[model samples]
Every structure is written in C-alpha cells, then in structure tokens.
Target: MTLSSENCSEFQYQVLQRSQTLDANCLLFLIILGKMLLNILTLKMRRKNIYQNFMECFCISLAFIDLLLLVNISVIFYSRDFVLLGMRFTKYHICLLTQIISCTYGFLHYPVFFITCIDYYLNFSKTIKLPCKWQKSFYFSTVILIWIFVLAYVLGDPAIYQSLKTQGTSPSQCSVYVSVQGYWFSFSMVIILFMAFVASWPDIYTLVQAIRITSYKNETILYFPFPSHSIYNINSKKALLPRFVICFLGTWSPFVLLQVIILLFKVQIPAYIELNIPWLFFVNSFLIATVYWCNCQKLTLQSIVLPRDPFVNWKCCFIPFTINNFEQIEKPISIIVC
Candidate 1:
C-alpha cells in the first residue's frame, strides 16, 4: 500500500493520514451502499409508474449512476490486486475517479432544474397536454443529455483536473469529494429556502392559529374534527398560502438547518449523500411550491395538474378543495388548487 512520494515530508504525511483516510473511506462506502439499497427498493416499488413524473425520470438515471459508483468503489475495496489491462489498480486512481464522478454529478442540478422548470411551465401555463408517451421520451432525452453534457464538461474542465492532481500529491482530506458547484448549489438552495421561510412567517402563524389537527400523519394532519369550527374557512386565500408554508417548513426545516451548518463550517458532502432521495424529494416539494405560488390563481384540484407527491401530501394545502368550490373556482381560481 506504499505510494511513491517525492519527499520525506510527503511520505510521512501519508503514513500519519492513513487511519483518517480509511475512516473517511469507510463512511463513504457505507453511504453509497445505503443509497444503492434504498434506490433499488424504491425503483422496484414504483417501476410501473416511474415515467409519470419528471422527478421519477431523473431517479432512473440517478439510480444507474448510484449503481455504477457503488460497484466501482466496491471493486476497488475488495480486491487489492485488481488490475485492468497492463496497469495495476491503486487507491489514488479510485479516489480520482470518485472525485471526478462526484464533481460531474454535482453540476447536474442546474440542467435538471432548468428542464423541470420548462416542463412545469409548459404543462401549467399552456392549454395543450402532452401525451404520456411523448412526456416519457422528453424526460428520457433530457436525462441522457444531462449525463453526456455533465461528463463532458467536468472531464474537460482544467479546474477539476488540477484539484484532483493536487489531492493526489498530498494527504487528501476526504476520501469522497464535493465539487465547488455542488457546495454552492446546496448553499444557494439553503438561502432561497430561508428567504421563502421568512416571507411566509406571518402566514404560517395565522395558519397555525386557524386550523386544529388531530395528529401528525399526512391524512390526519389536514383533517378537521366534527362540528368544530376554526377561524379559517379553509376556503380563504389566507389559508392557501399558509398551508404551503407549513408543509414546506415542516418537511424541509431540518435539511435547511443541515445545509446552514454545512455552509457555515464548510462540510464536504459527497455526491451520493448530497444528491439523494430525501434531497430530491425536498427539491420536488420546493418546485411544486414554487409553481403553486407563482400561479396561485390557477389552482383547482380537478382542473389543474399538480403531480401527486408520494412523500409530502401537498393536496392538504387545499383541504376543503371539493366539488362544492368547483363552480366558484371555475369562474376565478385561487392560490391553493390541485
């Protein structure tokens, strides 16, 4: 396991760093393993309906990437004498590969965001509905393009090359890597969400005062008990905005705090951990919230097409959104529909 070094200083550093490096490696390995298992189970359960949503399409590609990353890391760990062609495998190559893959994965958030934005905009604002087959193809194409573009850009960029090279020649701090783009992306999301939280504070307070829930579960959260009349009519625009805020705050406040600490102390999050199921689900919630906020006047459960979330039940934002209001909503829609 001895690596050739240019000086006594470098050699001594690697020796002392070995334990720390192994610890980081073990953590990284465990994380990827968990993600792989969760992803496989989710895909198995949702296989039939995966093509129905934009996030689900992204999950297909992410699951493949997760599988590849896990397999590569596993092979590098289990077989010390593993060799390919004429070259012997070593720790350095594996670390470099991990860094590169991570950096590439980090940059993909942008493309995914952009494409999803366009998809939502077209779907909500436009009258024509795209056929299911066409929608599938659209997501498939974007996922493929996202992989190709991110790989090409990251591999071609000199910054990533220099970063990995620098780490190779020294006692690298982390076995898994977080790219600049990934760090800032996480940072930016935290800030955006914080701003949203602040903006909705008054509304959230009002909503809390307006409704009384029996329990914390999704179905029970929105339920109003018999004969008890709360201040909220549940039909008011005041209730609409607050329900979204409460839902967003409830589901994501912890992640937002985690990101804040990450940004404050500068935690390096590996790709597999950073771009995960919970993170994606949060992003899905955020996107849906944004769309709902922007087009508040166009929300009717039956007329509008808000994707049914498996995790956060967003329809609670419109708890009383029944056929009774259908006639009224048809004339002039409000903020919390569909």
Candidate 2:
C-alpha cells in the first residue's frame, strides 16, 4: 500500500532531523576526545615545568583555551530545547555565546604560536640577551594582554549584532546566520589568514636553518659546559620548534585556505567540507596535544638520564643524527674534544 503525501513528508522530515542529530552527536564525541587528550598533555606539562618555561606555559594556556572552545561548541550543538546544568538558556543565547567564545579562542591561537616561535628563536639562538626573570615577566604579561584583546574584539560589534537580533524572539524561533559573502567578513578572513601565514614564517625559517646547519656535517655535535656542581643536565634540551610548527601548519592551513576561497570568491562550500570542518578542528587539537605530550616525554627521559656518559654527552644533545661509515670516518680513532 502506498503512503499518503502527508505521511511521506512527515517521514522525510523525521529522517532529516535524525540524520542531523546523529551528525551533531558524532562531532561532539570527537570534540570530547580531543579535549581529553589535550587536558592530559597539559596537566603533564604543568606538573613537569610548573610554568617555569615559556613554552610549557604557552602549551598549557593553549590547551585550556582549546578545551573551552570545544565545550562551547558542544553546548551549541546540543542546546536545542535542552537544559544545561539546571539553567535553561535560549538556543539563540547559546549560539551567540558559542560564536563569541570560538572566535576569541580561535584568533588567540595565532598569537600563541607566533610568540612561542619568537621565544624559541631568541632562547635557542642566544640572541638579545635578557635576564631570565625579565623574560618570564614579559611573556606572562604578553599572554594576559593577548587574551584580553581577543575577548574584547570578539565580544564587540559582531557579537552585539547577533545578540540584538535574537532579542524579542522566542527561544524556539531563535536561529544563527553568518553572512559569509559580506565585504567586511571576507576582508577579515583574508586578514586572519595573512596574519597566520606571517606568524608561521619565522618558525619555519628557524627550523630550516637549524636543519641545514646540522645536515652539512656527518655528525653535528653540541657542547654545553654546565657548572660542575649542577646535578641536572640542562644540555640535552633540544628545541622541538620544527615539530610544533609543522603540526600547526599542517592541521590549520587547509581550513584557512578553504575560508579564504569561500569568502573571497563568494563560493558556497561543499556539504562534505561543511560536515568535516569541525572534525578538522578536532584533528588539529589532537595533533598539537600529541606534540606537547611527546615533548613532555622527551623531557622526562632527559631528566632520568641526568649524568650521561661524558664521551657521548656532547653528541646526545644533537638533533637529526647521521650514521657514518668507516670510509667517512678516515680512522677508527675516538676523537675526544673538550
């Protein structure tokens, strides 16, 4: 027996709604997984360094911000006719708050990577010598200022407009709309992508230079003359700048490029891409978290092997080691240089 037209329409609607709900739940699951991984890595780093190093502090702060953003997105996903923690928020309010928080946290990621790169270059290159206390204070102040500026910018005009639109509307009638084709919006996307590219360049350059310098010789050796009385081996702290830079760029560049194309050309994004963008963000979060976790592992191993063999001590600090044949070595003599 054929179904009535009204019944067919109702069935289609139910199927669509169910599909959307399933998609949202899957995205939320991915976000939760990413947050859990990041939290574990951040906690480990905090315990290891206690915010003593600028990189450790930056990683912890970034992880926290990312978790907050992910939670906000998850709230927005399931806020439809739902009560959260005994308080009922209109879907409009939830969506607006989510947008504001996401934008603030997303844009803030740029500066974190930028400043981390700068710090890496300065510390490793031994350029622009400054007191340790002064450097720490400067970095801490900069992080605070960046968050303040991002929050202010995100909550200013754009958020206010969305908030005003939702006013006087019933909770069930509330919805979110972003004008991707607007001139100002496109311009803003361009500006953001440009800034990210510029910010990433210095780190990329530093990585390339380091690799090139190490590649020319068969075995690149690093000698750190620590104080005789010092128990901890500070010599093996090789900067993982290259890995961090690669991870960030690899994960984010695709999303940024997609935004640029869509905004600048007034092109509609494909349904597949629209569905996968959130997952991309999750992948990015996971990769960055793994980078921090790996670095923490390296630090832990280095701490364990504090007083290494003096013969291999100079070579252990070297990154990107190469194996040498006897022909390259010229002789079987052990050359010890103090």
Candidate 3:
C-alpha cells in the first residue's frame, strides 16, 4: 500500500514510540530480575543479619514499585492513540495506582536513609548489641512510622486533591499531575531534610577543622580525607559518611535542584525535566548496588554460589572453568573441516 506523507509521519512516530517503550520495559525487567536473584543468592550464602535482611526486603519492595510504575507507563503509551481503547482501560485507575506507589516509594526513602545512618551510628558508637529478633522489630517499627508519616502528610496536603481534579488529559488519558506549586514545596522539603541529616554528623570534626584552614578552596580535594587511608576504613563513621553524602547528593542532586529552580524562577521546565526523574531513579539504583557490592563483604558473598565460603576470593575459583571452556572451544575449531 502506498503511504502519504501524513500517514508516513504518523506511522514512524508510532514505531519510534513503541520501540522506546519496549526498550524501557526490557531494561526495567532485567534490573528487577538481577536484584531479585542477587538477594536470593546472598540470603543462601550468609546467615541473615538484621540490616542486610532489611535492605534486601526493602530493595524487593522498591523493585515491585518500579515494576508497577513501568507497567502503567507502558499501558498508557500503548493506548495513547485510541481513546476508546484507553477509555476501556481507564487512565485514572492506573494514575491512582501510580500515585499511591509513588508516594509509597517516596516515603520509603526517609526510613531507608535513616536506617543506613543509624546503622553507621550504632557501629561507631559501640552501643549494646541487640538480638536479631529485636533488631527486626525495630526495623519494622521504623518502616511503619515512615508509611504513617507519608500518609498523614499526603492527607493534609491540598495538592493531591487539586492534582486529582485534573486527572485525565483527555477522556482516554489520565494522569495525576502535581501542581507546579505543590511539586516545589514537596521537592524543597526533601532537599532540606537530606541536608539536615547530612549535617548532623558531629564527628566531622576533622573535615570542619580542615575547612577552617583551607584557603582559596582550589586545593580542597588534597585537604579532604581520602578513602584509601586506614583511618578512613575501620571507622564506620568516616567510611559511611562519604558514602551517604555521595549517595544522597549524587543521585538526587540534579532532579531536586532542577525542580527547586523551576519553582523559584516560575519558569516552565522543559519536557526533559520529566524524563530526568526516571533517569535519576536508574542512577540511584545503580549507585546503591555498586555501594553495597563494594562496601559490604557480606553482600558480595551472596551474589554467587560456591562449595566453600565464597568470601575466600570467588575470582580465584572461576579460572579453572574458564580455562576448560577455552580448551574445549579450541579443540572443536581445530577438528572442524573447512
């Protein structure tokens, strides 16, 4: 069939859109699967520790939320052109689901963050060690508190109500769009809280003292504590502080600041702003996995299976299998008839 210019443009747009949606779904699926497998493998390898178990469970929950968000986005995109098809599905239902999930995951940030900080504090403080059962109870209570706070705040905020009113773009398409004003307030609060938490480090005595003497700040990197030093390693206070800052600021710095600026300046943020939110999520996920892998010896052992204690250097054991595979492939090639 011959295609007119209008038809060709429309067809190409649909194909491009579908291709992008499929890519996102595949990437999200792989990430979720990788996380789940890693968690299972880790659990099998090591006796469960309280912090580790909480992290694994929390990650699983986050993964589920991510999966839900992706599925909703996919459905919306798939039905974009056909209002009747979209109407049959109802965007409002999906949008509500997304909002709930979004709020759930957003609130989870505080507790997870607080727990990480507390974990570091407890390790450094040399306080009385609790039994695993007690620790589990404490962790659950913290999570409950987090959710309660989220619900309470959401209920009080008039923004959600306003956003609900504007739910669907067309009869076919629904979205819970946060008012620009509400978005700014919520975004600012998170940034302020994050900064406060980071600033609560009293033991940053050295860094603070160093800051006083460092003039011009151009040589600041040289003056700051480097990770390689023994002083930095054993002290959970020192080690975790940097990790927390890197994670808290690095992953979120872009989107948070962007929102704040957009709100303060009363400028319309470019379409790219919405796109960055998901990109930030991906960055945060990768950063957390990397941090856990690099710092937590207990976590690394669980990512793979082995006969003996895998902590005894897993890389050394894989060489023999790799060599055998290479030899087998070499022999097959040598014996092949041209």
Candidate 4:
C-alpha cells in the first residue's frame, strides 16, 4: 500500500486507535487478575482475621465494579472499532452494559475509597486496635454510612446516568474524562483525593511511630546486628509499606499533577502527554502490585509452598510450625503439619 497524505493520516489514526484499545484491554485484564489474586489472599487471611476483613471485602467489591467497567470498556472499544472498520456492531446491548457499569463504578468507587480512608483513619486515630473484636463493628458502621451516602447521591441525580448514556455519540468519544456527568464529576474527584489521603495515612503514622520509637529508646539495636542511631534505623525492614507508598506517590504523582495542571490552568495538554496518561496508569497499577509483592512476604511464601500442601485449607497452608521445647514428652508428639 503506497501512502498518500490522506492514507497516512488515516493510518496514523488507526494506529493510535488500536494502541488505546490495547491499553484498555490489557489494563483491565491486569486489574482483573490482580483483584482475583488479592481476593484469594484475603480469603486465606480470614482464618483468624488478623487484618481488616471489612476493608478487604470493600476492596474486593470495588475491584468487582472496576472489572465490570473494564469489560464494558473493552466491549465498547472493539465494537466501535468494528463499526469504524466497516463491520456491523450489532450490540446496542454493550451501550446499556457500559452505562450500567459506569453508574456502578461511579456509585461503588466512592464507598470503597471512603472505606479505605476510614480503615486507615480508624487505625490512625487508634479507634480500633489490631486483633480487636470492636474493629468489625466500626468497619460495618462506616461501610453502611458510605453506602447510604453513595445511594442517596447517585439516586438523587437522575441526570448522571442519562447524561452518560447520551454523552458518547460513538465509542471513540466515550470516556469518564469527557462524560456528560459534567460538574458533578468534580465532586467525586474530591472524594478520590480524600481517599488518597486516607490511604497514605497509615504510612504517615508508621513514620511518626518510627520516629517516636527511635527518639525514646537507646537499647533498640536498629535493624541489623550492627549499631546505628536507633531512632534512625529501628526495624528498617518494617518501613516497607511506608517506603512503598512514598515510591508509589512519586511514580504516579506526575500524571495526577498533570491532571491538576490541565484543569486548573485550562491549558491544552499535548497529544503525546495525553497518550502517556494510559502508560502512567499502567505504571501506577504495577506499583500497587509491586508493593504487594515486596511487603507481603507471607503471600510470596504461600505462593511458593501452598501448591504442595496436602491439606487444602488455605488458612493453615501459610503457617509454618516450629517447636521450642519438646524434651520431656512421654509419647511422641505428632506435629500439626500442614
């Protein structure tokens, strides 16, 4: 195919279109797989429930909504592409599905983010302690409140869904960025910012706690067997989560700041920069997975060993048992082996 100016323009457009389509499909699949894997970890962790079960459930629900949205996005992307390529797009059903997913995404995302915030906030405030029974109560109460707010906010504005359905004349035109939700979208954005703050709270708290613990103690042997300023280096390995957060924010901050710049300054973001947004999202997605991989050593251990465990109980599967004192046992002690 010899390229003319018109053909070149069209080919360029097609390439950009396909790139965006691939980005959407790939990102969604990654997120879906990540969510499923995380859920499996959560279920396994639910044995004695050392972690926040309520928060895990909320996270899972949010992932479900996201998965639904991703699938919708995938359908819309390809369906629209087919139409453009002179193929029949027989599915008005995809539009409805997309609408429903958008509404659900808009509805569910708020509560999940808020719940994540509240989960950390509760931790920050010391309103609940780890391994405490009252924590569940707090989680439920906060979740219920968030749900009530989401339901009321979503239902009260009938125009949001209507706008979403009508806003995109074609699949290429469809996006949350340019959606018909209009000014109200800003409100949800504020909520997302708040959630981000909440998510970072634990990291902040851990840092502060580290500082405090370092300040007051002298016998603290600072991470390794070697000696350094105890305050400067106590359990440095434990700084994983906070360090991960710092790195995450650092990596993704440019894209977020770009959004702020584009909105507040009302500047025309360059096409290259706009295209980079999806890649930035991809980077952020990887950061989250990396954080999980780095911080959750138990998860990594489980992944390596659990396949070989005779008992299929995911709970007991991760636990490695060791006996401290067994010198005077009359009968042979049977190990409670996994």
Model 1, runs deviating above 4 Å: 1-24, 38-51, 85-87, 126-128, 165-176, 213-239, 321-338
Clashing pairs in 1: 299-337
lDDT by residue (tens digit), candidate 2, 220-287: 43322223453423222233333333444444566556666776677643221122223223333433
TM-score of each: 0.75, 0.40, 0.37, 0.36
lDDT digits (tens) for residues 31-123 of candidate 3: 445544554454355433224334443444444545556666556545644455445554334444445544444444445545544554453
The Cα error of candidate 3 at residue 240, in Å, is 12
Q: What count of clashes does model 1 give?
A: 1
Please tell me which predicted candidate would have the highest TM-score against the true structure: 1
lDDT of 1 by residue, 1-338 (tens): 65555677787876778766666657668888998887777556442522266777887789888888888877876674567998787655557767777777778777777777777777767655878898788778878888898888877889877887676544364356666766767777778777766776776665555454433322344532223343544344554566776777777788777878889998777774678766776677688777766776676665333555545656656645533432232322222322
Q: Which scores greater on lDDT, model 1 or model 4?
A: 1
Clashing pairs in 4: 214-231
Whole-model Cα lDDT per candidate? 0.66, 0.45, 0.43, 0.42
Candidates ranked by lDDT:
1, 2, 3, 4
Q: Can you rank all candidates by TM-score, best first? A: 1, 2, 3, 4
Please give the TM-score that candidate 2 achieves against the real structure: 0.40
